[model samples]
Target: MTTEEQTAVHAAMVAAGADRRPGGRTRTFHALLEGWGVEVAGVEEGYAWCGPEFDNDISCRSTLADVWPLLPPRVRSARQPRLDELDERFRAATIEWPGRGDEEQWWMWRIPRLLVIEPGDPYEGGWPAGWTMMPFPKPDSVRVIT
Candidate 1:
């Protein structure tokens, strides 16, 4: 994340009293952010995002949902509604498709899904070879995927 973004996240966490909370709660919040592809560090200086640029991915929906109730009312009121709106749009653009045979279902979003292939992976021979493209479902409203 950019220094500005890291500062912003750190400020938000501090404003939410993350540093004052029990260690477990702070750790849980840190883990959630990390799972969202954010690099978290500086626990003693208060939590900060030290990762690559923040993409504000759909994964943030779960993070917000899980942490909403734990935040101070002021923080929740300041941020949750806007995040909820964005999450709704993301959900509308996403489809949960059942997997073939015994595999579990997975979510497919309207945007292109990035697949990170390791050097020895079977699909590493060519880019886009391993991808399964799907047509987006017809939206009932103009707001979907807008």
Candidate 2:
């Protein structure tokens, strides 16, 4: 992950209030990222896409806010700056998919998605291998990768 991207993921993790411990779910997610060459230091129920010069973290089970109460008061306070930093760095990537807000997302594993890169950030390796490619309305839109 690039420095900016790493910061974004770390910030997002803090913001999501993800529990810092590794469990079965976290291990599964970590292995997946590792196979993709993404450096994963922590594991949780969510998945992260981090690689050399690549930056993005996606969580399916939790976001910082979802698990806020689970975090210690000190940790919560420390995360404010990271959260604040993320507000400016990250932007929602519009994705056209069925049941965005509903529980019926076509790609069930992509929930709690986070796009660490900006709208115009240059990315290489384009969605990794085996990702279903579809035309997106805009560069800022999230493409459905089956």
Candidate 3:
């Protein structure tokens, strides 16, 4: 990732209150998410470390929105339309951006699929109806200070 992108991720970590001690960081981070109306399905090993239950289940689109400006110019340009396409399908759906790739293309978009909804391939086969995929920095792409 570019230096600016890295900075953006770090800034997000701080904004999420992840700058605290290990135990507190998780608490503080989750609290931050709660303040933003994000539903915590469970913490998982992924880009943000916290996996949101659904697109609208969490109102974290704004939180993830913070990282957009810092992405490489080409990536930002390419990803915007993909985001729009998914949003059109699922109104008010939160984006679960998986992060950018080393190559020129962007990949990995997701939203948690609750039992109420059917699960399917995130790509190729297409997501289940009412599902929306958002964007987020990759886990390995950003150096988040824990």
Which candidate achieves the best TM-score against the true structure?
1
lDDT of 3: 0.38
**How many clashes does the backbone of model 3 have?**
5
Query: Which is superior by lDDT, 2 or 3?
Result: 3
| Tens digit per residue, CA lDDT, model 3, 31-140 | 43343332332211212323334333334444435544544565557657755554443322223344423322221244332223223323223322222232332323
| Tens-digit per-residue lDDT, 18-121, candidate 1 | 43334554533444444433211111122222112112333443444545566555555665565555444443433233232233212122332223334454
Q: Candidate 2: which stretches are off by over 4 Å?
A: 1-56, 60-63, 92-146
* Model 1 misplaced stretches (Cα beyond 4 Å): 1-57, 99-128, 132-146
What would the per-residue lDDT of candidate 2 be over residues 96-132, giving only the tens digit for each residue? 2333434432222222233344344454535432232
The TM-scores, one per candidate, come to 0.32, 0.29, 0.29
* lDDT against true structure, model 2: 0.35
